[model samples]
Target: MNTENDNDEKSMTTGKAQRGPLRGMNPIVTLGSAALTLAAMALAITLPEVSLAWLTSLREALSPILATYYVALVGFFLVFVVWLGMGRYKNVRLGPDDEPPEFATFPWIAMLFAAGTGVGLLFWSIAEPITHFGGNPFSEEAGTPSAAIKSLSLSFFHWGLNGWAIFSVVGLSLAYFSFRRGLPLTIRSALYPLMGDRINGPIGHAVDIFAVVATVFGIATTLGLGASQMNTGLDWLFGIGVTSTTQLVIIAVVTVIATGSVVTGVNRGVRRLSEFNLGLSMVLLLVFLVAGPTVVLCAMLVQATGDYLDSLLAMSFWTGVSTDYQWQFDWTVFYWGWWISWAPFVGMFIARVSKGRTIREFVFGVLLVPSLITFVWIALLGGTALYMELTGTGTILEAVREDVAVALYQTIGTLPMPSEAIALTGGVATLLIAVYFITSADSGTLVITTIMAHGDPEPPRLQRVLWGLGVGALTAVLLVAGGVQVLQDAVITAGLPFSAVMLAMVVGMVRALRDERFAPVPGQKHRLAKEIWTGRDEVS
Candidate 1:
């Protein structure tokens, strides 16, 4: 199935052409999601402090129990993905058997990496590891050599393989149902096997509505967070004020740029920005690695990767009952919830770009490749900070503790470059953050608009502009009242229900995969390998 623009979308699914602003949209789901979004914005605007307090209290109360569920569920996702990718289901295509991928391999990966990580990797890469190193179950002591290694391992546990597996499951389920089974590419379509025709009625409507609402909130929260980071980056580099007004300005500027990208659709604007950010990210990472203790970072990567793999299961299953329970609620649980909430937005975007590929190739490319690259990034950047901290050569730990936003710029300043070169590198890092923010907003806009249009791959440009402004305004208003952080906590707490939705999706995907009429036999090892490698399964 070829992707379409909103103009083309009108005639493809509909028997006759339509016109006007709401053309090519599902009115009920669209209006319902819009209403909820507006209500959230009102809550932020009117009772900012009360909203903050309630959301905080709710998160603290629920995350303890929810963290355990998230842990168990995410661990299972990784295992399931591994089995599906390497076993009999390996050769199953996401679309028709003869269809080729929509985007080339490099561009495909670039977009995936951009949408999945974005400002997250930069915001957390150094800051998260240092915080864990300061104190965690794996590394209880503050600055011991052992503490440093295990601390990096904990970072890997959160940002590595398991997280990508979550995205893989969501995308696979949606892609399989929508492309192969001829269902609409929305949350409801993936549940067809379990829900049957009910998915076409209220049940389906509710599923799609909930996904749209959750995704809208999640995107707003991310934009708010990214705007905050950009505010800090400006102050760190050029001494621009880091006030709320500055953040509001940042959001406004980004929203405009993102709106343009969304209107242009994925291939032209989104693809180009993702590719640029990916390259700039690599360049910055290389500079950091070379400028600071190259041999030490490499050794740490090797050792920390080994440690991470060896204790993966123990860490994955740990609910912190025996260890630091509060830490579990604070860090790992928070990450899982955030990832689950984001699955709808990121998964749909990935599915749109990943139209034609085998389950095996998709799993390997989607789950493993980004994970490995992020692991290296975390190791080098965080590893460099840890080395300096342990050696007592840098004061970055002080900045990290006091203000995490400036920790990255602080790391850049401490690099062994001259003052002029240091300033140049810091500018580049700041530029990277802004680009990532743009890509994220653009991708999120595309995803939300697609859902609003009832899974039309290319949503109308008008719908995209509407959702894009809605999210930007929501973030800007919250930033004004200083409610962005509170709203983020609230939305992450809201992710609890979406976690259940994801579990249901897993069940539906399994049933669908098992129903595949012609899968290679597992006992025929040679045939299975050939089928997987050549993208042609042997029909029984």
Candidate 2:
């Protein structure tokens, strides 16, 4: 092994991992992702009008399988993560036996929150519940007690464990393989058990190429959406024009800030930004809880929590096969696709910051803590909207229907605080959205650097900036072309390949975990992956 390491070092020094004069860069992934991005940009620019027609036709053909696949993927991940956290492998550490976590609990959890949801929580916290309250298959009649109850409960369902489970599954597999075993921290490493050294060849490059493209398009879509929301917030607060020029400015500003964050590296730039995002989220959440219908929100929180927990099992598998398949495809299936599309970026970010945590610790912490905070955040913000609608003090549902972007501003507008304080709250909400936007972009930048550098968590600063700018440029071009939805559809297309990749990772993870190093605890028999022909314990 030492001899092999020496040879490998010599090879890297002789430029196996180098691209001519460039050091620590993988040209295949870098150029491949860039080429893919340019192709997508060309489509979005030259043919934005009919961009969705082909994708719509394609998804229509694949809708049944795609929806079923995403649903099952989420369901399988939920069970996999819960079992890891609670069952025999609970004690397995992500690193050496005595290794301590790199970040403290608070910062770790804070960064986890930043990586997972970011701006979407603020954007949807007000919009989604109100949409459901207006009615779903569960309640076609709007503005009723049942609708309100179902609203918050459904929000919990979408934002809760199902989404996080996908992240956890990917993060856990990568962390276990990278840290516990001696592998590079890249998606290809997840297949080492099945592929052996073949992961170092074309197969590995192909997998990573797919991951890079998916991640690039995924984050670009978010930048476009987040910028639009920020544009709306600015117009609502400061009367700025909601022109494309305004949105371009917003995108440029976010790109510069995110680039700055990535340059400082994770310990300072990313970690500080994440902590700030968490703190600001709490400040906004607490203000809403205090200044709004405080008691009613609390009561709603309890009832919503109860409802979410009570109906989790049923709802987890409740695809709209029988009733309103379009509705489920639009909402639940859309979200599942969104999460899957983001798994590479978010999951890789989580794994990078999550060294030294036990499997149990990582699983539960990722699943429960952020999820509980989300519940409270949604209940506070969305619940306040429900209360106003119930009492007829505000037209939140109307605003949501007309324009979901104003939903947050509208919720703040109706707060019982004085007129001046309402303006102050609006400013804070806007700032929160901007910070969430920055956290997400910077986080994606950092994660992309690793993939581009072939899994170096501390990748080159130049490459980091390049990746960050790449995302910004893609968003700007799409925004200017009026083709963000086109880019988004392209992301959904990219995600189909990755969906298969995720399933492969799962099978490899199961096979890899059965190695002798992860033998059963004392007196507890290992769940046998019995030998069928060879001596190795393989799942037959």
Best by TM-score: 2
Q: How close is candidate 2 to the true structure, as a TM-score?
A: 0.93
Off by over 4 Å in 2: 1-16, 19-22, 481-484, 516-540
lDDT of 2 by residue, 40-96 (tens): 778867886655687677666766776677787799889988987897678777766
> For model 2, what is the error of residue 38's alpha carbon versus the real structure, in angstroms, after optimal superposition?
1.1
lDDT scores for all predictions? 0.81, 0.81
Q: How many angstroms is residue 290 displaced in model 1 relative to the true structure, after the best TM-score fit? A: 1.5
Pairs with backbone N, CA or C atoms under 3 Å apart (clashes), candidate 2: none
Task: Give the alpha carbon lDDT tens digit for every residue of 23-79 in model 1.
Answer: 887777777788877887798789888777777888778767876888999999999
Deviation from truth (RMSD, Å), model 2: 3.8
